[model samples]
Structure formats: structure tokens, C-alpha cells
Target chain A: AQTVTQSQPEMSVQEAETVTLSCTYDTSESNYYLFWYKQPPSRQMILVIRQEAYKQQNATENRFSVNFQKAAKSFSLKISDSQLGDTAMYFCAFLTTSGTYKYIFGTGTRLKVLA
Target chain B: DVKVTQSSRYLVKRTGEKVFLECVQDMDHENMFWYRQDPGLGLRLIYFSYDVKMKEKGDIPEGYSVSREKKERFSLILESASTNQTSMYLCASSARTGNSNQPQHFGDGTRLSIL
Candidate 1:
């Protein structure tokens, strides 16, 4: 079985500051994918960033980046220059290439950007 | 941009009533998914379809059924709505690319309330 864990349930960041949300996962497969999704108050789940397990380089999208450590089984999201619009529920997800390609999601971290 | 749209943004149903939630993706994605989101549990996959008329049960498929008769449309059905089922339901679609790095495009979730 695969499992994803998000340690922090809630976090607050000052405007224009940086914040890192921690995530760790347990999976036996060597080839897989990790993703970070943001759900704002409007309840739209938006893809922030994604990383392939085979890639050593981390994935970065605009102001969001991920620290993916395959050996440690950890994938964390870092938001630089956080703005009020970044306030949302952040979820870390893991996907295996085998079978139907289902995603295993971690319990989310509610992030609030304070001005 | 990929667009995934749910038929309803909010819904209300009664106990023991059969409820249907509809989703459509315009990107011609071969894979579609339905998920339930709660306060701290993040998103739990209820069901998914890899192709038309092919479905698979996800981590939390109990009391839920899904239909995908068309490539662009997926429908989730609740046999009997319950209070516990009152949560945000999200629909997502992703291309069936051979690589595992494809990120899912999600719709604005439907907030369902059962009384």
C-alpha cells in the first residue's frame, strides 16, 4: 500500500514571505509521480507542481517549487513570495504508474497568507 | 487550458435519495476521477475510469457508483445519500500519456449536503 503524509495541518505566512509545507510518502514502486495541489476557498483544485520519481531535478512552477528526495521518500512544497491568493488547502499526492494510475493523497495543510 | 466542469457547484439531497453528480472534461482526456474532500482528510478517491465504460473502484468507493459511458463525461452516483456524505466532491481528468508525470486538471468541486 502507498501512503502520503503531510505533517503540518495548518500554517500561516506573512505577505511576501516564503513558506514550506512538508510531505512524506511510503511507496515500494521505484517509478512514480508526486504532485502538489492547491484548493482555494472557491474549492477549485489547482495543480501547483509535479515531479517524476526518475528525475533528480525538482519541479518548479512560477512561485511554487518542490523538494523531492526519493531516497528519503519526502516531497515538500515551497511557496516563494507568498501572496494572499496563495491561501488555500495544499495537498500532496503520489501516483504510481502501474495499474489504473490512481493517486494517493495526503491529508491537506491549510495555508493562510497574512497581510 | 484544460477545462473540467462539474454540473453543479452546490446540491442538496435527502437521506436514502439517489444522487447523481455529473462531470465533463473538454480536453478529451481518457482518464477521469471522482474524489471526496473533507476538512482534514484531504481528497479520497471514490472511483475512476480509464476509458469509456471501464471503471475502477478507488480507496473509498463504498456506497458510491460511477458511470463513464463517454470519454468526456463521468458521472458519480450515490445509492443512498447520507449526512456523512455531505462534503465537497471533485472531478478531475488527465491524459493517458505513457509517462507518469501527467497532472490532473480538476473541476470546481460540488458541495453536496444531505439532510
Candidate 2:
């Protein structure tokens, strides 16, 4: 079984500033994928960024990036130049390359961007 | 753009009532997923379908059943709805290729209240 943990329950960031949401997972699988998803007030889940366990380099998508430390089993999301639209609930998810490809998600971190 | 559409944005039902949540995908994805989201808990997978007529139990399948008659539609059913089942239900779909590591496209979600 795999489990993802988001220690931070809630976070707040100043507008135009940067914020980092921490995430950790316990997985025995060597080949896996890590993802960060954002759910806005509209209740739509959107993919923020993704990182493959085999890829040592972190994944970056515009203002969203991930700090993936495979050895530490840590995958954190960083939002740079945060805006009001960035205020949402963020979740960290894991999926192994084998089996049914079901995703395991963390509890989530609610981020609020302050003006 | 890949779009996942859930049948209802909001629903209210009484206990012991049979509830059906419908999901449809426009991308012809090979995989479809149903998840429930609570206040603190992140998205928890209830069921998933890999192909037409092929369904699999996810992390939490208790009190939930699913049907996949077609490749583009997956339906989640609660045989007897309870107050505990009241939550935001999300539907997602993704392409299942060689590695099956593609990001999932999600619906806006259906907020169900079981009174």
C-alpha cells in the first residue's frame, strides 16, 4: 500500500510572492509518478505539475514546480509569483507504473493568496 | 482539450435511497475514475474502470459500486446512501498508454448531500 502525506493543512501566501507546499509519500514501488493537483472554488480539479520517480530533474510548469527528492520520498510543490487564482486546495498524489494505476492522494493543503 | 463531465453539480438524497452518479469523458480515454472528497481528506478513489465492461475497486469501495457499459462513461452507484456518503464526488479520465502515467482530466465534481 502507498500513502501520501501533506503535513500542512492550510497555507497563506502574499500576492506576487512564492509559496511551497510540502508532501511526502511512502511507497515500495521503484517506478512511480508524483502529481500535484489544484482544486479551485469552482470545484474543478486541475493538474498543477507532475514528476516521475525515474526523472531526477524536478518538473516545472510555468509558475508551478515540484521539488522531488526520491531518496527522501518527498515531493513538494512550489508556486512562484502567486496570484489570487492560486488560492485553492492542493493535493499530492502518487501512482505506480504497475497494476491498476490507481492514484493515492494526500489529505491536501488549502492555500490562500492574500492581496 | 480533454473534458470529463459529471452528471450533476449538486444533489440531495435521503438515507437508504439509491443514488447514481454519472460521468462521461470526451477524450475517449481508456481509464475512468470516481473519487470522493471530504473536508480534510483529499480525493479518495472509490472505483475505476480500465475499459468497457471492466471495473476495479479502488482504495475505498465500501458501499459503492460502479458500472462501465461504454468506453466513455463510468457510473458510480450507492446502493443505500447514508449520511457518511455525503461528500463531493469527482470523476476523472486518462489515457492508458504504455506506461499509463498520463495526467488525469477531472470533472467539476458533484456535491452530494445525504440527509
Candidate 3:
């Protein structure tokens, strides 16, 4: 079984600053995928970024990037130049290379971007 | 653009009543998922379907069931609504295989309250 862990329960960052949310997972599968999802006040889950375990390079999507360390089993999300709209609950998820399309998600971290 | 739509944005049900949450995807995605989100608990998968008439149990599927009569529709059923089940329900869909890295697109969650 794969388990994703988000150690930070709540985080706050000033507007225009940068913040990093930490995530770690335990999985036996060598081939897998990691993802970060954001849920805003509207309750729509949006994709932030994703990383493939086989790839050594980290994934970046504009202001959102991931620091993926395969050996350490760590995948952290970084939000650069945070804005008020970035305030939301962030989740880390995992998908194994094999088996049914079942996703394992971590307890979310509530982020507040203060102006 | 890929879109996943949930039947209701807010629902209020009485305890012991039968509850049905409907989800439809227009992207011809083969994989459909139902997840429940509670405060601090993140999103917990309830059930998923890979094809029409094919359903699979997820991490927490004990009190729920699913129906997939068509390729693009997946429904989550709560046999008997309980207060504990009062939470936000999220529906998502994605391509079944090959493009596994493609993120799951989600609908605005339905907030369910059992009174």
C-alpha cells in the first residue's frame, strides 16, 4: 500500500512571497506518479503539478513546481510569488504504475495567502 | 477542455434516507472516481470504474456503492445516509491507461449534509 504524508497541516505566506509545502510517500512500486492538487473555496479540485518517479528532473508549472527526490521518497510543492488566489487546501497524491486507477492522497494542508 | 460534472452542488438529506450522487464526464475518459473529502482528512476514494459495468473498491468503500451503466457516467450511492457521511463529495475522471501522467480532472464538489 502506498501512503502519502503531508506533515504541514496549515501554512500561511505573505503575498508576493514564496512558500514550500512538504510531502513524503512510502511506496514499494518502482514506477509511479506523484501529483499536487489544489482545492479552492469553490471546492473544485485543480491540478497543480505532477512528477514521474522514473524521471530525475523535477516538474515545474509556471509558479508551481515540485522538488521530487525519489531516493528520499519526498515530493514537495513550491509556490513562487504567492497571491491571494493561491490560498487553498493542497493535497499530495500517488498513483502506482500498475493496478487499478486508485489514487492515494495525503491529508491536505490549508494555505492562507495574506495580503 | 475536459470536463467532469456533478449533479448537485449542495444537498441536504435526512438520516436513514437513500442518497445518490451522480457524475458525468464529457471527455470520454475510461476512468471515473468518487471521493469524499472531510476537514483535515483530505480526499478519500470511495469507488472507481474503469469501464462500463466495471467497478472497483477503493480505500473506503464500505458504506457506499457505485454504478456505471454507461461509459461516461458514474454514480455513487449511499444506502443509508448518516451524519458522518456529511461531507464534500468529489467526482473525477481521466483516461484509463497509456497517458497515466495526465491528471484527473475534477468537478466542483457537492456538499452533502445529513440532518
Candidate 4:
């Protein structure tokens, strides 16, 4: 069983600043995937970024990027130039390489972007 | 673009009532998932189906059942709704391939209130 952990329950950053959300996971599978998802007030879950365990390089999507340390079992999300729209609940997820398509998610971190 | 739609955005139900949550995906994804989101619990998977008529239990499958009669549709069932089940329910779909690294697409979610 894989378990994702988000130590930070709440995070706040000033507008136009940068913020990082920490995440860690425990999985015995060598091949897997890590993902960052955002949920806004509308209650819509949106994919922020994803990283493949086999790939050593981190994943970056515009202002969202991930710092994936496979050995440490850490995958953190970084949001640059944060805006008010970035205020949301962020969740980290892990997926295995097996045929199943289930995700293990962390408790989530509520991010607030201050103006 | 993948589109996952839930049948309802908000639902109020009575205790011990049978509840059904419907989800439909237009992207022809082979994998569909049902999850519940709670404040400190993150998103816990209830059930998932890899193909039509094939269902699998996730982390928290107790008190929950799922049906997948069609490829694009997945339904979550609560035999007896309880107040503890009052939470946001999320539906998601993902392509079933290891090489693709495809992230799951989610719907806006259904806020289910069981009283």
C-alpha cells in the first residue's frame, strides 16, 4: 500500500511571491507517478503537475513545478508568481505501475494567497 | 480534452436512504474512479473500474458499492446513507496505459449531505 503525506495543513504567501507545498510518500513499487491537484472554491479538482518516478528530471508546467527526489520519496510542489487565483486546497497523489488506476492522496494543504 | 461530468453538484439525502451518484466521461477513458473528500482526510478512493463491468475495491470500500455497466459511465452507491457520509464526492477518469503517464481528469464534484 502506498501512502502520501502532506505535513503542512495550511500555507500562505503574498501575491506575486513563491510558495512550496511539501509532500512525501511510501511505496515499494519502483515505477510510479506523482501528481499535484488543486481544488478551488468551485469544488473542481484540477491537475497542476505530474512527475514520473523513472524520470529523474522534475516536471514543470508554467508556474507550477515539482521537486521529485525518488530516493527520499519526496515530491514537493512549487508555485511561482502566485496570484489570488492560486488560493486553493492542494493535494499530492501517487499512482502505481500496476494495471490498477487508483491514487493515494495526502491530507492536503490549504493555500491562501494574500494580496 | 477530457470531460468528466457528475450528475449533480449538490444533493441532500436522509439517513438510511439509498444514494446513487452518477459519473460520465467523454474521453473514452478505460479507468473510472469514485472518491470522497473530507477536511483532513484528503480524497479517499471508494471504488474504481478498469473496464466495463469490472470493478475493484479501493482503500475505503466499506458501505460503498460501484457499478460500471458501460464504458463511459460509473456509478457509486451507498446502501444506507449516514451523516458521516456527508462530504464532497469526486469522480475521475484516466487513460489506462503505463507509458502515457496520463493524469486523471475530474469533475466539479457532488456535495452530498446526508442528514
Candidate 5:
């Protein structure tokens, strides 16, 4: 079974500090995509960063980055220099490219960027 | 820019009432999806359409149905609204690329309250 796990239910970080959100997924497919999505309070979610399993190098988008470990099936998001606007619910998602189009999402981590 | 719009941002429906949540995407994406987001459970896919008038069941498709009469529109229907079904409904669209996982563009979710 393919499942994504976000162990941290909630997290807080001081302004200008960095924090990491943990996510671990179980999948047998060698080639796939992992993504970090941010959902602001009472708003829709948007893609933050994406990483392809085949790439050894991690994916980074501005202050957001992902540590994608294919063998271990772990994908975690790191936020650098947290800002007030960054307060939102962060979700980790996995998508298989095997024509099944099965996308699995984790129970999100609510992140708070404190002043 | 891709714009995905849900008909309503908040909806209230009584028990036993039929409900419809509409989604329209202007990007001409071939794939459309419906998902319910609940606390701790993450986002569970209810249904998805790869083409006009074609839909497939997702992880939790019970108590729900979908229609894609047009390529740009996908509608999720609840046969009978129940309290358990009260959650944030998210509609997403993505281009179908056979070889890679395409990131989904989401609309502002509809928060439905079944009372």
C-alpha cells in the first residue's frame, strides 16, 4: 500500500528561524514525484516545491527546500528564515507516474510562523 | 496563470439533501479531481476525470459521485449530505503527461457544513 505520513501535527518557529517538517512515504515505484503544498488559513493550497525521485539532488524553491531520499522513501520540507506570511498548513503529497495516477497525501502539519 | 474556481467558498446543507460542488478550470487541463480534506485524515480523493464524461473512483469514493460533462468542468455530487461528510472540498486540475507526474493546480476549497 502507498501511504504518506506526516508525523508532526503542528509546529512553530520564531521569525527568521528555520524549521523542518517531517514526511515519510511508502511506495514501491522507483520513479515518482514528491511535493510540499502550503495551504494558508481559510485559503486554498499552492505547490511549494517538487522533487522527482530519480534526481539525486534535492528540490528547492526560494526559501523552501525538500530532502528527497528515494531508497528510504522519505521526503521532508525545510523552511528557511520563516516569515509571518508562511503560517499555513503544510501537506506532503506523493504521485506515482505508473499510469495509475494515484496521488497520496499525508495528514498535514499545521505550521505557525511566530513573530 | 491557471485559475481554478469553485462555485462557492462556504456551503451549508441539511441532512438528506443533495449537494453539488462545482469546479471550473481555465487552463484546459485534461485531468480533474475531487477530494475531501478532513482533520488528521489528510485529503482523500473522491473522484477524478481524465476526459469528458469519464470518472474513476479514488481512495474514498463512497457517498459521492462526479460528473465531467465538459472538459473544463468537474462537479462532485453528494447523494445525501451527512455530518460525517462535512469537510473542506478541494478541486484540482493538471495536464496529463504520460511520462511525468504533473503538479495539480487547486482552487480555493469549499467548506461544507452538513447540519
Candidate 6:
């Protein structure tokens, strides 16, 4: 069984500033994937960024990036140059290559970008 | 662009009523997933189908059943809807052949309310 944990329930960031959302997971599998998903007010789930456990380098997508520490079992999401549109509920997810390919998600962190 | 369309954006049903949530994907994805999202709890997988007529139980499958008659459509069913089942239901699909690391495409989600 794998579990993802998002310790921060709520977070706020000023417009154009940067914000980091913390995430941690417990998994015995060595080959796995970590993902960050965003759910806006419209209730659409969007993929923000993803990082593979084997890849030591962090994943970066435009303003979104991930700080993946495999040894610590931590994968955090960083949103740079945050905008009002970035306000959403962010969730961290994990999926192992083997088995059922089911995703395990964290509780989520509600981010509010203030103008 | 991949499109995952859920049948309803919002639905209201009474207790003990049989509820069916439909999802269709434009892309011929090999995998489809059904998840439920609550206020504090993140997206929890209810069921998933790897191929046509092939179904698997996810993390939380109690009180839920699924059907995959075709490759592009996956249906989630609640035999007896209860108040506890009221939540936002999300549908997602992804290609799982050589690219199992691909991110999932999600639907807008169906807000189900069981009263």
C-alpha cells in the first residue's frame, strides 16, 4: 500500500511571487512516478508536472517545477511567477510501474493567489 | 488534444436510487479510471479498466461498480446511492503501452449529490 501526504492544507501567495507546496509519500516500490495535479474552481483536474523516481533531475514545466528527493521520499511542487489563475487545489499523486497502475493521491493543498 | 467527457456536470439523486455516471474518451486510450473527490480527501480511485471488458478494483471500490463495454467508454455505477456517496466524481484516461509514464487526461467531473 502506498500513501501520499500533503502537510499543507491551505497556502497563499502574492501575485508574481513564488510558492512551494510540500508532498511526501511512502512506497516500497523502487520504480514509480510522482505527479502534481491542479483543480481549479471549474473543477477540472489538470496535470501540473511529473517526476520519475529514477530520474535524479527534477522536472520543470514553464513556471511549474518539482523538487524530488528520492532518498527522503519527498516531491514538492513549486509555482514561480504565480498568477491569480494559479489559485486552485493542488494534489500530489504516486503511481508504481508494476501492479494495477492505480494512482495514490494526497489530501491536497488549496492555494490562493492574492492580487 | 485528448478529451475525456463525463456525462453530467452535476447530478442529484435520492438514497437507494441506482446512479450511473458515464465517461467517454476521444482518444483510444488503453486505460480508464474513476475517482471520487471530497472536501479534504483528495482524489480516491474507485475503479479502473485496463482494456475493454477488463476491470480492476481501485483503492475504494465499496458501494461502486464499473463497466467497460468499449475501449473508449467507462461507466461507474452505484447500485444503491447513499449520502456518503455524494461527491465529485472524476474520469480519466491514459495511454499505457510503451508510454506508461504519460500523464492522464481528465474530464470536467460530475458533481453527484445523493440525498
Best by lDDT: 6
Per-model TM-score on C-alpha atoms: 0.96, 0.97, 0.97, 0.96, 0.97, 0.97
Q: What's the DockQ for every one of the candidates?
A: 0.69, 0.76, 0.70, 0.69, 0.76, 0.65
Clash list (residue pairs), candidate 4 = none
TM-score of chain A of 1: 0.97
Runs off by more than 4 Å, candidate 3: B99-101
lDDT of each: 0.92, 0.92, 0.92, 0.92, 0.92, 0.93
Give the DockQ (C-alpha) for candidate 6. 0.65
Candidate 3 interface CA RMSD, Å: 1.9
* lDDT of prediction 4: 0.92
Candidate 4 vs candidate 6, DockQ winner: 4
Tens-digit lDDT string for candidate 3 (A1-115): 7899999999999999999999999988999999999988876889999898999999999999999999899999999999999999999999987765888999999999999
Stretches off by above 4 angstroms in model 6 are B99-101
Worst 10 residues of 1 chain B by lDDT: B94-103
Indicate the DockQ of the complex predicted as candidate 5.
0.76
Judge candidate 6 at residue A34 and give its lDDT: 93
CAPRI-style class, candidate 6: medium
Q: Model 1, A23-113: lDDT tens per residue? A: 9999899988899999898867898888989999999999999999999999999999999999999999998977556889999999999
**Cα TM-score of candidate 5:** 0.97
Q: In candidate 2, what are the lDDT values of residues A1-115, reduced to their tens digit?
A: 8899999999999999999999999988898999999999877889889898999999999999899999899999989999999999999999999855688999999999999
lDDT per residue as tens, model 5, A1-115: 7899999999999999999999999988888888999999998899999998888999999999988878788899999999999999999999887877668899999999899
What's the true lDDT of residue A1 in model 3? 74
lDDT of 6 by residue, B20-40 (tens): 999999999999999998888
lDDT of 4 by residue, A1-115 (tens): 7899999999999999999999999999999889999998786889999898999999999999999999999999999999999999999999887755778899999999999
Where model 5 places Cα greater than 4 Å from the true spot, the runs are none
Residues B1-115, model 2: lDDT tens digits: 8989999999999999999999999988998999999888888889988889999898899999999999989999999999999999999999978867588999999999999
